[model samples]
Target: MTQRTDVVVIGGGQAGLAAGYHLRRLGIEHVILDAQTAPGGAWQHTWDSLHLFSPAQYSSLPGRLMPAQPGQTHPDARHVVEYLAEYEKRYELPVQRGVWVDAVHRDGTCLRVASDSGEWQARAVIGATGTWTRPFIPAVPGRREFSGRQLHTVQYKSPAEFAGLRVIVVGGGNSGAQIAADLASVAELTWVTRRPPRYLADDIDGRALFDAATARRQALDAGHGDTGGVASLGDIVAVPPVRSARDAGLLPAKPMFTRLTSTAVEWADGTLAEADAVVWCTGFRPALAHFASLRLRGTRGHIATVGTRTVDDPRIHLLGYGDWTGPASATLIGVGRPARDAAREIASLLSG
Candidate 1:
């Protein structure tokens, strides 16, 4: 028997939860299908030392604020996991755990969401599956011949694993900087980036970045050009640990190497740096493989979205995939507004 629902949210992460919150407020019936057995979404998969670049007050969902811990400025991965679990319980959101969605296709006027557990025929489908699973590693020449350990940011757990060894951290983003800082304390670390790393002012944090992004988005929406230069949330924020690393003169980043040798990396200038492990913090791509059958994906593998709704399919909305869906929508605080609007749109569609 095919289960029927007014809406089927294809992820129980922050975005999905936010959508559910708004849907419930509007008296709409929906179910959130989560692939994970537990709560926390992608945060559960992050490294132990990972902390939010924003403080607790700035990193919250709609209708409820995340409680700030005493003496803790930024929330860690475990704290986020706990908060997400509590948030789900507080709202009594209808989330089905361990239900991995395989594909979503059009069935008559409704959307058919096929999963490992069962199929759901929903009037609308929200793709809130974030980019944790699709880690991106740039191809480098002679990468296959590298004899040392190679791991992406998704697989990184602790710097203790690379302690006392020569490690090379790749990418110029926040993850690369943070991981490089963490490993610098106990390991011989080399930071590599395609271009020079950009660091925001010491006083700046994730909250400022979010505010800047919001302003830029609002300006663009109002038919005005963004004339100011604002640092994105992806830029390094110089958190306490990062600052400490910088003060110690250990945060120097080198240009990307040309190729990988068995136990060394060859630079553009033909300099060889021996390394025991290489950590690629190159970031992630949207996890939209389940929607491949819909044939809505563009050349970049991302569906064309017009403010969260698919350009081709109005009933299909994407959340938390990044700026294309909505500005800063990938963050906790950013997902709320878009989710609210998406829920309202879905409600109107169902009613009509």
Candidate 2:
């Protein structure tokens, strides 16, 4: 059975919720298909220790500010889930949970979205599926030969699970720093990165990052020279746990090792260390396999877009995939603008 609508937003996470808000505000009939079984979106799937980079008030959806958690400067994952679940209820967003989208392809003048629950034929499709489902690990040589467990950030939770094990935490991003910090007290931890990890100023948080991104976007829109945004500051923000761990020398990062062996990893200058497990915090690619039938990806695995609307197929838009789609769009506070853009553009396209 094919259900017709003006829009079909995939992934009922933050991005999808953001898009739904704008679509509803514009009176655009749409439904959000979320793969998750419950409300929180991807936040529910994050590690037990995961926390937002900014305060709850600073990180929020378009129309709702996440109420402050009583004692948290930065709300933990559960708080975020609570906020999201409540936000969905408050706005009464049309979300169909537990529906995994199988594929999206052109069907005449519309886009046909095939999913586990049913089918949706929409005049425009918002591909808001974020990257949490697609964790990426670099193709380091001999990775398969590792003797012990290999885990990605998506699989990681509390550090108690790997207590006393020799663990190498890989990647230079915030996830790497935080997870390594979490493991310091219990595990024999080695934090590995391609280069020395860069830490932003102690005071910097997601607020600063968002402001810098806004400045950069404005400068570019004004036809001015490039102003480096978050990258200009540093890769990892000095979140409390990371700062404590780094300042205390509990999170010293080693240069990335050359390859893995049956029992250990070998470094370039003839150094080797035995490891019982490896935890990869290397980040994620956009969860876009469902859009494969659209044949829209470039060699670099992205669809060309003018704002959120795909240049290849104007009937489709992408949201919250990262900076490429919109400045800081993947963050909780960042997805709103592109979502509104997508809604406006879809409104204009369909009306014409």
Q: What is the C-alpha lDDT of each candidate?
A: 0.90, 0.91
TM-score of predicted model 1? 0.97
Which candidate number has the best lDDT? 2
Query: Where does model 2 exceed 4 Å of error?
Result: none
Where does model 1 exceed 4 Å of error? Answer: 226-234
Among all windows of ten consecutive residues in candidate 1, which has the lowest summed lDDT?
226-235
Quote each prediction's TM-score: 0.97, 0.98
- Angstrom error at residue 253, model 1: 0.7
How many backbone clashes does every candidate have? 0, 0
- TM-score of model number 2: 0.98
lDDT by residue (tens digit), candidate 1, 1-352: 7999999999999999999999999999999999999999999999888888889999999988999866789989899899999999999999999999999999999999999998999999999999999999888998999999999999999998888999999988889989999999899999998888887888887678767777887887788987342554347878888889988999899999999999899998899999999999999999989998999977976688778999999999999887678777999978998999899899999999
